[model samples]
Target chain A: MRFIHTSDWHLGRTLHNQSLLDEQAQMLETLLALIETHEVDALVIAGDIFDRSVPPAAAVSLLDAFLDKVIQQLKVSVIAIGGNHDGQERLAFGARQMARAGLYIQGPVSASISPVRVDGKHGAAFFYPIPYAEPALVRHLLEDESIQSHQDAMAALLSKVQAHNSNGLPKIVVSHCFLDGGSESDSERPLSIGGADKITPALFTPFDYAALGHLHGPQYKGAEHVRYSGSPLKYSFSEQHQNKSVTLVDMVPAKAPDIRLLPIKPQRDVRIIEGHLDTLLAQGAKDPGRDDYLMVRLLDTHAILEPMAKLRAVYPNVLHLERTGLMQERSMEGPGRERMQKSELTMFEDFFNQVQGESLSGPQKALMSDLIASLHREAGQ
Target chain B: MRFIHTSDWHLGRTLHNQSLLDEQAQMLETLLALIETHEVDALVIAGDIFDRSVPPAAAVSLLDAFLDKVIQQLKVSVIAIGGNHDGQERLAFGARQMARAGLYIQGPVSASISPVRVDGKHGAAFFYPIPYAEPALVRHLLEDESIQSHQDAMAALLSKVQAHNSNGLPKIVVSHCFLDGGSESDSERPLSIGGADKITPALFTPFDYAALGHLHGPQYKGAEHVRYSGSPLKYSFSEQHQNKSVTLVDMVPAKAPDIRLLPIKPQRDVRIIEGHLDTLLAQGAKDPGRDDYLMVRLLDTHAILEPMAKLRAVYPNVLHLERTGLMQERSMEGPGRERMQKSELTMFEDFFNQVQGESLSGPQKALMSDLIASLHREAGQ
Candidate 1:
């Protein structure tokens, strides 16, 4: 059985206020081209097809077009799941009827026993779609209710799927979650801060092929069967060097699966060039890549004037300009009062009183502090 | 074909910070009961299932449970659309797959000719799903780009649908939008100020039955076929007197849509009583409807003392207590300084110049005006 694995589309994401829907649409089209060219058995979009729970209209239209072309027009079974970025209820709204069109969507947290069976050269294969599940939702859904984190949730989910596997057909599990030992970009929302428990590789132990999403990097953890088919487009400057690609998996009985990395050409090439302002200016003057998107990390002592305008004249795709040296030098500095306060008046008042101790009277300070505290609590709540 | 047409579930909606979800869930259960009793062919939810774009986790869970009961257990063919309050892309994310299970969702602004052919004893009926289309999106999607208003947009959509009437099946159009001759309450987002210009009834000229959402009132807009199913629960105090219901639309060939209003038992009843403070207090003391939700519209000459606390004792669901007479009087007296200049400084400046002929220096005035504009914009924005 041959399949294309891709996920974490993150559609409708904007860089600052700039809409990336057009680029996202182009990337999806490129993905469709891959599907057509490879003659893939199944296309698995694991999760996070949208950037937010409430995606804009453009994102919807794009996804709709993609699904219509790939699943409906091409006659390929496309299985999608709800990622952390999706609202499960919304994602699962019309999923029941969609199954008839050979487009399977599993958006709920529950793990069903019988997978949607698909015939392959290897005889028969069962594909189980497991959407991203929160610990609390998983706990409520599972009878045992022992799951305390994402790892526990996945374990519980896997156990359910494992219990129902009577027929020895090769099984594949497509999931949208952060796997342990996988490198994540800053864009991926942290599941938990103090949990080495979250990144455990034990979650994907039950399935033959574990296609994962969430982590934008295309890599595997401890298990060779488990892999992440990274996002098609470069979303952030941090992902400038990432060779964005999809994974094609050919599964056969009692043997290792053959994996092929198919490169995806982004709408614009994303590259980071490091140099001082003078060097960067000189580089721009000589010849800057016109088509490639550039993120110039200047090692200048200060901010440059009209840097974007000057660079954009040469390289039309210069989306970001940064002073890397300044950021590095500023990183070690003491936390400013503004950073500490963060619009919290009570915290600000406390710091203010501490700094100007003699100026505030006891009663006045008490009144101000209480007022600030109440307001802060009200606003925060 | 017998079907229940209902919409605007708004599962997470709060009546002035008071949770109405429990009440809504109970009412939905009542609607489910109606579906069972009526032996409905399908359930049409036009749109606005959740109150906000990002519904709470609890709301998502509630919707999940409801869908499980309705589509999974009850075996109802549920067709829905995305409303203005809904994030269309998110709501329709997995809709392509869900459609296989007798759940059809149409979310795009384009005149997508989606028809669910439901076979019944009489014949097959085509249920056309047309979600609300904003004017701007309609202009972009329509073949004729001349559509400038909501009316024009709807006309264009209707024309498209009329052009593709291949099935010739008894068609019913399910839409989530404002229509002509509908009155909007405070809770509804204003589509247009005038009645006729909001949405012309001619938009549904091609359909045999028109099932509409948005207007939270059950009424036929001078046409037997064109009607609003209305919201299932009272969303605001303005709708306190509304008999919340699901329209049991039974369509027969060569006859008008036989619509039956099946009342839903609200978990907490919404009632708005108007009286003076003393009279209201006496009425609450005497009457014994403690369980029913109350939104007291006090007509007191002066503001009452601890009105919420006092009302909450008798009517636990005293979600709102506003002096209607006071508001009316205030409005009648014309715009106050707060409504005019919008700030104390602006009011002072206007007053000083107008009454005392006191002029400010150029720099001082400029600085003051800038500061005033900044503060006002900050507050407004």
Candidate 2:
């Protein structure tokens, strides 16, 4: 059995408040091309299909279009599961009816993890979808009081799957979880604030392949069979250096699965640069990839006049700007306990200087003094 | 051919901030029973399936459950369309894929109107769905600059359906629009603010039957074959007296369609009661349907102490309250332009007197006087 494994599409997500719908559409097109080239039997989307519980309408439309092409046009079965970011009821709305079209969506976790059987060139492969669930939900569903963390929940869930797998068929487990030892990034939300949601690598040892989501980096832990396909696009500055890719797995009866990483090229790269404003402007003027999203850190100590406007003239996609050295100095120099004893006028001047990195001009000082006098006069009336 | 016609479901609607989901679910159950008893071949939902473009998740779940019962369990075809309240793209999402399961939803207006044919005891009947469209959209789709009003848009749409009906099959046109001479209520939104959306009754002359929506009251428009099924529940107080129903239509080739109105009993009746506060309380304690949603008009001249709370003790669903005689007097005696020259203290006293329907007590008057003195003192600082 051969299949394309992808996860963390995060559709309807915005990077620096810029819509990624067009880029997401382009990436799905590339995914389709890869599927056709590899002649994959089925498509497995692990989870986090939508960025949020209630996504915008355009996101729904895009997912619908992609499913129509893959399931209806290509005649391939698709197995999708709901992640932590998904609304379980919304995702599970029409799962039963949609299954008739070869689109299987598992939104809620249950005690019996039913495996969907699909035919391939090798033999029949059983695909098990384990959607995201909390410890309380798992405990309630299994009627077990010992389940406490996400690790315990997965253990309880897998025990049921193990009990049902008496046939010893080739099995693939698709799940959305934060596996232990996976690298983290800024854009990926922590599964649990208390740091109790991580699952050990040994829990996935029984499956021929474990397609995982939630950690936005393509990697493996301990064994080659378990992997995180990662996000298709760079969602934050911290992820600028991570290589985004999807996994394709090939399996045969009584043998280890073969895996290949298919790299996806984003429409525009996310880049970060640090230098003096003048030097950065010079580089921006000559750069060929000017449309890439950029976060710039300026080393200059003094404030520049409308630096963002100047930078955007040459690099239209500059999303962020920072003067880290000067900002640190201003923070250290801010008013302390003496601020309460100082007059309002003196405090205002200090705040203005701190924000703009300069003292008030002569005319501006006069304006402030006059405004304060008027306020006092009004109070005295 | 025999079918059940219903429209303007407005699922997820609220009456005075109270959710109508339970009532809607009960009504759907009644509708399902009706379908079974009548042995209906298809279910036609003209438009307005949801109350808002972005319905709550619970509403989506309810609608999905209803569809699962009707389409998957009973094996009946469902044909729905987008109304002005629906987000067209959202409603139309997954339409092509859902059609395989005998559920059809049409959104956006176009020149090509595809008819879904269902086999019935009377031979074959073709159902043409014309979703609501603006005048501008109609003009753009048909490539006709002359389409300027909703009437023109409907005319242009019907022309296409007429051209497609050369097979001489029994045709039923399902649409969502306001027809001329139809009596409307407060709950129904005007299709167009300029009144250009009202279509003439003659537009349905070519079809064997026209199942319409948008009006809350079920009534025939000029002919027996053309009718509105009305909403299944009272959405507003204005519709409290209107009988809510679904239309059951029976048709054969080359004959006038037979229509029957099946009245639906609401979970709780919306009622209006007017009397003195004492008299209302006496009546509320004795009424059998005390749980009915009530709008009360109290005729007391003096202010009642927490009237809403008092009424709710017996009538738990009292959604609105109006102090009729005192409010009328207050409105008549409101301050006019001449009061602008009056002192703030006098204005405050008058406002308090009007709201309370009595002058300030000794302690209250002294507190107000002291508050005014403190304000003056602060200004003099």
Candidate 3:
């Protein structure tokens, strides 16, 4: 049996306020090709199906189009779960009825996640999909107070899953979480937002393979059998050097699964370059992939007039620009550190002073402060 | 064959920013009772399944729950369509697969709508669901430039639908539109947003019955069979006098449809009361439906201090307040008309001057004007 494992399709994501939907749609098309070429029996999507809980209607349509092809047209079985970024209950809308049609989507966290049994050429394999949920919710559902962290939550969930594995066929665990040794990328939220804890991969010993997600980078945590397929595209600038691919798992009953990293041909590549402004513009003019998403780090010492405008004319997709080398400390330290410590109101006040050549009036300051505070409150949530 | 017709659910709508999700959920549950007790074979949600294109996740969940119970649990056939408020392509997701499960959702408007044939004890019947769409889109899709108005759009669409009715079984047309002669209410948007350009009910002549939507009152525009089920709830104060109900159409081939208005018991009634401030507060304290949504119109000539707060203390759900009698002309004419005529920036400027005891300085005014203009541009869209 062959299964393509993938996750964190973060549909509807934007980079530097530029829409990545075209790129995302292209990625899904690439996935369809891989599914056909790989001769995959089942598709495992380990969550974050949407970038936000309430995804844009376009994103929803994108996913619907992709899944409809895979499940209906391709006639392939799809096993998906709710991720940290998904609206769990919302994602699980047709879990019950859809299963009859070979689409099994795990919704809300339950005490016992029933194994979805799919019989391949060799034999039937049971897939235990552990959807993401808060530790408190998992604890309440399991009626076990020991579930205190993400690790504890997963462990508790797996224990319940282990109770149904008496069939002795090839079993797989599909989940979305940050394992203990998994690497983090710039696109991922940190421990506070992501709740990264000691979620060791050892909990999956009862299963043959563990399909994982959450980290954008694809890697095995503690065991090769347990792996992350990684995201289809580079979401952040830090991910530029990373090779993105979907994981292919070819398996037979009671045997080690053959894992292969299948590459996806992205329509546009994300590139970062560091050089003098004049040199970069000259190079960009001669470059083949000038349309690629770029973050240019200028090394020029003195002030360059209208650098971004000049760079954009040459490299139209330049999403970010920063000054490095001689300008590193000058730009990042001193005033920048002080600037970072200031409230948005103070920054706005400074900008107003610079533009208008006058300090903000008392009432204007009050309005600015209230607006800034409201924005902060909303962004915090 | 008994089909229950309902529409304009406006799920996720707020009455003056007060969440109607709970009330909406309750209404769906009440609908479940009608479906169960009346033994409904099919459900036709004409349109406006949601109030916005991207509804809150909670609203999606509520709809999932209601549709799940009806489609999966009760095993009833549901034919819903996208409305002007709905994201058409988004709502049409899985339209093909869902049809096998007896849930037919019309996605984007097509050149010709294929009738879904459902067999009942009285033989097979055809359901033609013409989902809400734009006139220009319909014109382009049909390759007919003659479709300029809503009336022309419906006529062009119905001609295509008529070609499929040679089977002679009972046929019904389900659609969402503003018919020419239908009465309207405040809750429903004006023609600008709703596109009410003389879509006469005569366009539905080929069908045995027309299950209509968009209007809030349950009534027939031209013929008795061409009826609007109305919204299940009173969305605005203007609809308080109208009775809300679901339409049950009992049909047989070559026989007239017996249309019955089935009532759904609501949890709390919407009310509008008028009286002097003190007397109203005293009456509100003793009113049985103090917990219900209220729009209290004060008759007192003098300004009342913290009137909303005072009213809320006695009647917790008092949603809106107004004044009549001695307050009519003063509240609606002169300054009110002048206020409407002035720009939002000008109004804010006057308020700022009155509250702060000083006119805004130049830069402050510029900032205020920019913010107000931005808000207006967004709200206008």
Name the candidate that leads on lDDT.
2
The 10 consecutive residues of candidate 1 chain A with the worst lDDT sum are A338-347
Q: How does model 3 fare in lDDT?
A: 0.82
- Model 1 score (lDDT): 0.75
- In model 2, residue pairs whose N, Cα or C atoms come closer than 3 Å (at least 3 residues apart or on different chains), thus clashing, are none
Cα lDDT of model 2 by residue, B120-236, tens digit: 654668899999889999899889999999889999899877888547778899999999999997788788897888999899867899988888889889798888999888988
**Candidate 2, superposed: residue stretches over 4 Å from native:** A110-112, A165-167, A324-381, B328-381
**Candidate RMSDs in order:** 14.1, 6.6, 11.7
| Candidate 1, A37-100: lDDT as tens digits | 8888788888998888767867776887788788777777888888888766666655555667
Error of 2 at B295 (Å): 1.2
Ranking by lDDT: 2, 3, 1
Candidate 3 chain A: worst-modelled 10 consecutive residues by lDDT: A336-345
Error of 1 at B173 (Å): 3.6
Docking class of 3: acceptable
> DockQ, in order, for the candidates?
0.27, 0.45, 0.27
Using TM-score as the measure, the top candidate is 2
lDDT score for residue A62 of model 2: 92
